[model samples]
Target: MYQFAITGLYQQVLGGEKLNQIEKTGELTSSRFTVRDFTELVKIGIVNSNTITAFTGMWLAFQLNGISFIQNVDVIFFTIVGSALIVAASGAFNNVIDRDIDGIMERTKNRPTMTGKISGKRALMVALVLGVVGTIMLFMTTWQAGVLGVIGVFLYVVVYSLYAKRKLVSNTVIGSFSGAVPPLIGWFAVEPSFSIVPIMLFLVMFCWQPPHFYAIAIKRKEEYAAAGIPMLPVVKGIERTKKSMFFWVILLTVLPFFMFDLGLVYVILATLLNIGWLALSIYGFKMDDSIKWAKWMFVYSLNYMTILFVAMVVISIFL
Candidate 1:
């Protein structure tokens, strides 16, 4: 029933002409659809990155709650795999929805959705299967985790992608909510309750996204402008975007203080990472070439997130 409903919605949104093009090209059954195309469509990088945070959240929950990891292998597996699949589904949905604008942006032009290597119907089907299965797995782990997963999908697909991306400059901020939910899902899967640790983890991820994505927006401002996407850098100019990044990075510095229970090592490491990011954010104002500075900021943000989450799991276990 759900499948039929989704197919109807796709048909309505895609219209007769686009559907005919897909059918006439026979791309769905063509040899053009490779494993690489599928991975790209689902954004494996995003899946892997979010899964790390989810796993970190679960591992920290186990340590904090005095639970044995060895005894709950099934729960861990479900939490991580479910989280990854949901995130991947979100990516696939984004690809399908953004296919038009994606073709305009150089960075996204070669994607399977934009290139028509994968049909809209096929991508939608993949997203539906992954989303339903992932949601079921999360529900098996804990209702809280399952609910968070659903909320995350709603925010990413309906709120951010459908509305905010084209209509609002605050789209990145709105999208951050979905990106931050993975860790919460992981924590709830293990503990099934609220706590400051998970909240801090959520804030850490939430704050990290703006600076990270704003940098990409800065580097690709012209492409985004041509695509008519209201990314911060595209809509608000580079200087304003830099100030926003600085603000978020500053907020990120304060979150580690609230996560003190993760120990002095985690706190100290997080503090240093925050300070480094903050320093880089400050440097952006003085740079002559905004693109070069944004690139630097982008690279640091990736390293900062990976290190911070890894520290959380490591400190929780060893300390």
Candidate 2:
């Protein structure tokens, strides 16, 4: 009688499995991303803390060139938002194109597209939305701002990402133009006219990129080689890349002397910053071809740019 009762109870429990399956079926759901995931995507999109420097530099340029713009919050909003979104769009689109190669490199192996967190098609769609919306914001500021914004996008996406990055050894040069345009967009959103100072701003950023990028290329040459991207260090050899870096460092050191309107403080500050950078570049060669030195130069370059631009803003305001 006990055995019979136990068997009956087990049969009832077996039937409860059907109810459990029904409950689970009702609870079925798709994967949902967390806040942290969106944050990572933003980082991948290049809309992180570092972008403050770029946006601030542009805003400072606008303020210095046209002080009245500081009173116009709408223009300020458009310039900051438009420039950032365009940068994000460019980075996302580049990630989409470089996904395959990115997966092969240790440095880029865990990018969203590589890790399947974001599909390439999805990334492309995101880029499109960002680009279009950013352009619209800039248009609200001024048509010239909108035009420069679109040109920046085209240069980064088409000229650099699609063409030069894969085919030409001068990819860094081509890419620098896109990087340099944000300040011009900021300046023109208010000034709406061409000036030598804005052109000098563009040239400063343009000259700053080659040595900065090549230092990174030197540090990661093996990864770049494995990915089959002809970064300067990979195609031209590290020694030659170092010499090229040195040449740019020297040019970067001197470019500030011409920005006379930025005043003597800017000239002195920029000169001191570049001299430190130049010292790093020369010290790297003297350090017996150390990758450590390349790594140091890479880190120093970040500080160099931020400080140099901060000096521009300070001199423009206080001096």
Candidate 3:
């Protein structure tokens, strides 16, 4: 349903350079997918596919917790489906909102939008479908879980796509809410209980997003500036962005000790992870920052968050 809509929306909404590419290629030889055919795919949720795949790696972390039985068949099932839907919806919305800007940027120029594989109306429908389904499925877990799903959708779609992303300054802060929900989703999945620990995980992600995005923004500062998008590197200097990244890495690393009753294993591992990030940031600050360096940090950040959350589950096991 969304395949066509996303593509249509992209081409009509954003008059990108890729259109010429398509024109030159004369459609038949072009590598890009067409709007009509792509939309027809029943398996429309690539976001769902990736989310479920990543969740598997992180799922065991929850199992390690002393709780012994974090994996209720129902809970895992619902969490995957819920998160998948939300993630898919958010991805669709992101494509919809950034259709024009994405076309403007070389890196994003090949997205469904730029390729004319989907339309605005269709893309919006896809987003609504995934967003609604994801939220509804959360009800299978608990009302709170359902609400979390809703919050994730709202944060990504409204706060990030509509509000923060365009404004450029502090947009990453607003977008971070969407990224921060994963741990809470996992926490709520089993416990359905609230505590400072889960909140701390949430805060860690919130702090982590800026630096992660700043690194990317710095690397792609030209692309963003050309699109009139206000990334930190473009708005503030790269040095300032590095300094900000350092501040968050420091705070996020130190924050866990205060919020969770972590033992030495968890504490040491998390601290090491934080320090590692801070070290990278320091290096990024000292040298003329490179895209390669930023990419490394970005990849490491993914590993760091996954590791930290898994470690939390482990600490909970022995306690």
Could you say which candidate leads in TM-score? 1
Worst 10 residues of 1 by lDDT: 4-13
Residues 1-319 of candidate 2 have per-residue lDDT tens digits of: 3464334323322224432353345431114445554444444434542245446545665666656654788988887888788878877777766755775788778766555556544566677898889899988888988998889888887778766887888998889888888878877777788777778877888888898888888888899888777899889888888888899889887788888788888888888888898888887777885688888888888888778776776677764
lDDT of 3 by residue, 129-247 (tens): 87788777777777777787777877776667765787758888888888778667766766677766667767877887787777778779999999988788788867777788888
Give a tens-digit lDDT track for model 1, residues 1-319: 4464356446533635654476576743344789999899899999999999999889989999999999999999999999999999999988877866776789998888666677777788899899999999999899999999999998898778777888999999999999999999999999999999999889989999999999999999999999899898877799999999999999999998998788888888999998899999999999999999999999999999988888787778776
Model 2: residues with Cα > 4 Å off, grouped in runs: 1-62
Q: Cα deviation in Å at residue 255, candidate 2?
A: 1.5
TM-scores of the models, in the order given: 0.94, 0.85, 0.79
Scored by lDDT, the top model is 1
Ranked candidates, highest TM-score first: 1, 2, 3
Per-residue lDDT of 64 in model 3: 36
Models ranked on lDDT: 1, 2, 3
How much lDDT does each candidate structure score?
0.88, 0.73, 0.68
The 10-residue segment with the lowest total lDDT in model 3: 37-46
| Model 3: lDDT of residue 143 | 79
C-alpha RMSD (angstroms) for model 1: 2.7
lDDT of 3: 0.68
Candidate 1 segments exceeding 4 Å error: 1-31
